[model samples]
Target: MDYYKVNSKNLSLLKERVSVPTYDRTNVKAGILHIGIGGFHRAHEAFYTDELLNKNSNSNWGICGVALLSFDQRIYQTLKDQNGLYTLIVKELDGTLTKTIIGSIVDYLFAPENPIAVIERIANPEIKIITLTITEGGYNYNEATGEFEIENPSIQKDLKNPNDPKTVFGYLTQGLKLRKENNVSGCTIQSCDNIQGNGHVTKKMLLSYVKHAEPELVSWIESHVSFPNSMVDRITPATVSADMAALKETSGIEDAWPVVCEPFKQWVIEDDFIAGRPAWEKVGAQFVEDVVPYEKMKLSLLNAGHSVLGILGTLIGYSTIDEVVNDTVVSAFLEAYMEQEVIPTLGDLEGVDLNEYKKSLLQRFGNIYIKDQVDRICSESSAKIPKFMLPTVQSQLKDGGSIELAAFVIASWAIYSLGVDENGTKIPIKDAVKAVLHEKAVAAKSNPKAFLDIESIFGSLADSESFVEVFTKSYQNIMQFGVKKCLIDLNSKF
Candidate 1:
């Protein structure tokens, strides 16, 4: 129970006392190589792997985590200091909490110090799956084409010298080359990013690297590698002092690397793996033939809904999803937005009731205990917009439908680009177009096209007259009337 010490006894006590699920951690082999070792990956995929290990005594699905970015050294040291152990706290709406010690991670590799070593391990015949949580931006994609940016400096270096490239794609291609050279069959590359058709996107990126870097390897990867699309849902907020205090009170263990997430967790994976997979379904994972419809539903409705709350939440001076969801106006706006704008664009899918899904989404957003930060949800709007909002906008416009809500969301994004929140406090905007956006905002006065004109983010959609008119009108309204008033006007349209 000592705060400063972490040993097996304390870990076991914390798990037992907190009602954390303990897994049979011995028999699982290191088959999966995870690229990102961040909070969500630990709370979601790692948690799932832990459950699988607990159920199946002899599972072969342990994960070896690889950190590509420079900041990973601290994470590497933290996990290594604790002997590859960390606690995940799942907080519920009514103040209920459950803490679990995740042990599915068997090894760790820092890219800068041990890139080749990591690549070699990835090529191992026993390693049958390479999964990634490398975020939407980490793929080094060309914003205009949504393909892997081949001219990326890291990628260029990798192509010039396959033995050493700092990028994830570079490491992956190198590993695949090793696999081919050693006659070891290729592994399934499962992309867990929030992008729609994540697997296909990952394939395109990887194959793009292969085409120039290793053409022979490209053919083998095309034929052998299985890139399965997956929909991963979990609301994990950035850690705060309150979370640390809660962990201290509950676990009596001071965890420097503790992760706090909502009690709700969902993983819908396509049942496609080249070298086979674990019985993850036993651990409450949904396995289906095609994950596109489900992915679209979740991405457009749930994720996009979160974006709506995030931007508007910050603008309204709310700190968390729970806070924003409780505001009557915000809550009603989201409900109307989803029902009118998002749902109509979605095609029906088997085993999914759209109405029920919307209801559940509202409930999840209202779970006050989750404390999901608006800044966290709103950070990567540039990457997220295309996936979560654009498809719906395009569909609605093509059908000559009203896009009041969607347009408002775009206007909010432009407002966000102004670099100030409701209280006149500056909110840090992180995007590839941050500098240009700030300049444009200075000149254009919260004009939506100012941000959209960054052709990389919107592609040719920026030039569409219908989109321009709708978005421009919405932006002008928001600038004149503000978010709350704009919401009132949007509702009047219904």
Candidate 2:
């Protein structure tokens, strides 16, 4: 197979190999500016927009992708080189792969190279929606305090250079300022991360960041901007070299970076666009007045499911999520955890069937072809625990229900941070609070309460005696019997 790079020029030759963009490249205008072009953004947000373009829904709604961090430039350069075209290799549970060429992104800019270009892009009145998938950590938020880290050094620098700023919040305020000065309409800001009440948090943080950095812009921002809460779900594994290699070998299209996700994709967004939005619902997106029910369903069930087993997968030396979920004991443990703990906390959703959703998630997690890394899922459990896991504990405790699995997840997170797995192999841990977590993990070896006392990670759970008792017991069980045996023990007990 000849190595035909995916681009507008190679569209004809690679048409059968991968789905090509039907809309004329030149006619597509930039109407949406997406922050952080990562695997999830490409797989979920960009995929949906690509489908909308396929239906010829709106030409002005094309995406302008932006990269903020230094590492982001590497993968995004491929999109730029190929004229904003990339491949979506969707994986099925039974080893089927669907190759798609996504062209929703008409243009891309690395903000680190030139911030003004991105600023101008945001200031444009035609750009109505500014969506972000910068991840939970990228928000620069403290989950415990619900506060923006205003004291961050980068933010401090951005505070000094408000007009030519560095952070996302800086660009938001500065661009909105320019828009106001130019008498243009305000744009909607959509957050598509795993956080609960994502849009509400975005608005709160943006307002808080600017209140001190650019005080004058606060009221105008409050009146003009709209941050609609949204819930986006897709099991997009971080693209690896092998995925790219397979894509090229199979499709004869050499994509520098291609996203591989499970075939399941969903987006439930609040209908609160400030200016206007694309007809995404035409392509199966759900728009509701309140996205809380949907948000709870995803965060508690799907995300919490990943959270509960992610560290156990890492600790037991399972490389990918498929292998973890494939284990009969681990699968049974997850099934019991969801049924007895996580599901009891969720309210009845109007359109969604919770039981069916859980069944689908098990299949999604067990999709071997997708190769979702356990370390990737386990990575930042300190931050993730607050969003995906802690809420379940809070809700379960409120109802006076079982919290054994929730406690076990937290226990696994603490022990996993010790930088060594059960086999005594060194594990590289990544987190926003790794230093604090490491010290706590070490301290917890002698006293389990030491780890639970990390108020930022556990919040009020640290203050609960019953919660602490269960968590302490779970941690001790893992220490004595190892994660594998304890998992079996938990499955049988639950």
Candidate 3:
């Protein structure tokens, strides 16, 4: 027999590999308009929604996936080509693989091509919730001023042509403007980004953006809209053509774009939707009053562990996260840092075990099949630090807790940001502020204090004498003694 296709013809063949959606996708209503439909979105939110749709008959929540930026070209075209049907493969530590054909995405639009269509879709009374997964750097943030960059090129363009907006902020504000004009009800804007106070930050950024773009629309939005903070977690790696081939080989289904992730997934959402929402809680999703405890734990421990392994892994000559976490020294450093420095700053949960979570993170990072690239993990050092590790550092510094390991992680990034590893090979820096990082990194080699001068990443930490001393010493030590020796020595502190 020939290979199975993802369409209706090969349902029997596909059944062995994936749990295909049985519900009539045509009957599903577009209740959520999700922006930034990337791999993370497909694996996390789409997976959750797929479950809810499959289990419940009364749910009307189908996602209208929208690609807002130019970088989403590959995914936009792929999803369009596949008719929004793709395979998700969850890889386990023991080599057990489970596949699911997700069908929650009923429609998709590349917003850059037709911004007006996207805005109009957003204004639809049926779209009760709008979600986002745009990275931290995507927001129009001015690190120096600590406000939304109201005059950003995109925002400026959107302001002049609010009817046909380009930016996500523009599309949303204008969509709300249209909704207000039509006397439609307000919708929820839920942010799935890893930033702390994600909902609060989003509300502030949007309010700031709309203030400059549409002044009158601001007051109406303030009363009608809701910004719900969420904590989303899953270790979904970058899927190349190899992953697609793997799905084809294993399942005999030719999926254009396949998503591969760790077996673990988590979403803790604040139940604050302005419009009616999905009964996602019926299908393993946690609905809580406050997502702060879960968010802080995830960001501080898991994400911060990635930061440690990422920069240190590169400097120490490891390529992937598994390789980095497999190293006893790197793994030990992360565990110690979390228990002593990171965990101290997090709030205690009712039923969750913190130590088990930490251990599980190590196992997830050490998953052989995931093959999460350390360079990819460490790619955007400037952004990851402030979100994942800075909260812990800031909190630890205030309480006089152990920050030696945290200081070492930052020092490792400064050294790695120099664009050369310990082996004298060129390293690639892929940060939003790469130019500034490169400049300061080169200077920081001789004078580590210079790296801390990047106020956006480091803030006022450079001014503190004690922090300066610890960070400078660590950077110098890493440069002189190398990563393994420095980390091994740092572990001796505990």
Residue pairs of candidate 2 with colliding backbone atoms: none
Ranked by TM-score, the better of candidates 1 and 2 is: 2
Cand. 3 TM to true fold: 0.97
Question: 1 or 2, which is superior by lDDT?
Answer: 2
Write one digit per residue (lDDT tens) for candidate 3, span 1-494: 35776654555577766799878787898899999998899999999999989986556799999999887888888888777888889998898778899989989999888988898998999999999998877776765456788767878888898877778888988889889999999999999988877899899999998888788989898999999999999998888788888777776889878888999999999999988789888888899998888888888888889888988988878889999999998888889998899888876787789999988998899999899888788877787888888878889889998888899989888888888889987887788889999899899967899999999777898988888999999988888899999988878877
lDDT at 224, model 3: 94
**lDDT per residue as tens, model 1, 189-210:** 9998898899988999888878
lDDT of 2: 0.87
Worst 10 residues of 3 by lDDT: 1-10
Leading candidate by lDDT:
2
RMSD of 3: 1.5
| Candidate 3 residue spans exceeding 4 A from truth | 8-13, 143-145
Q: How does residue 259 of candidate 2 score in lDDT?
A: 85
Off by over 4 Å in 2: none
Residue 224 of model 2 has an lDDT of 86
| CA lDDT, every model vs. true structure | 0.82, 0.87, 0.87
In order of appearance, the predictions have TM-scores of 0.95, 0.98, 0.97
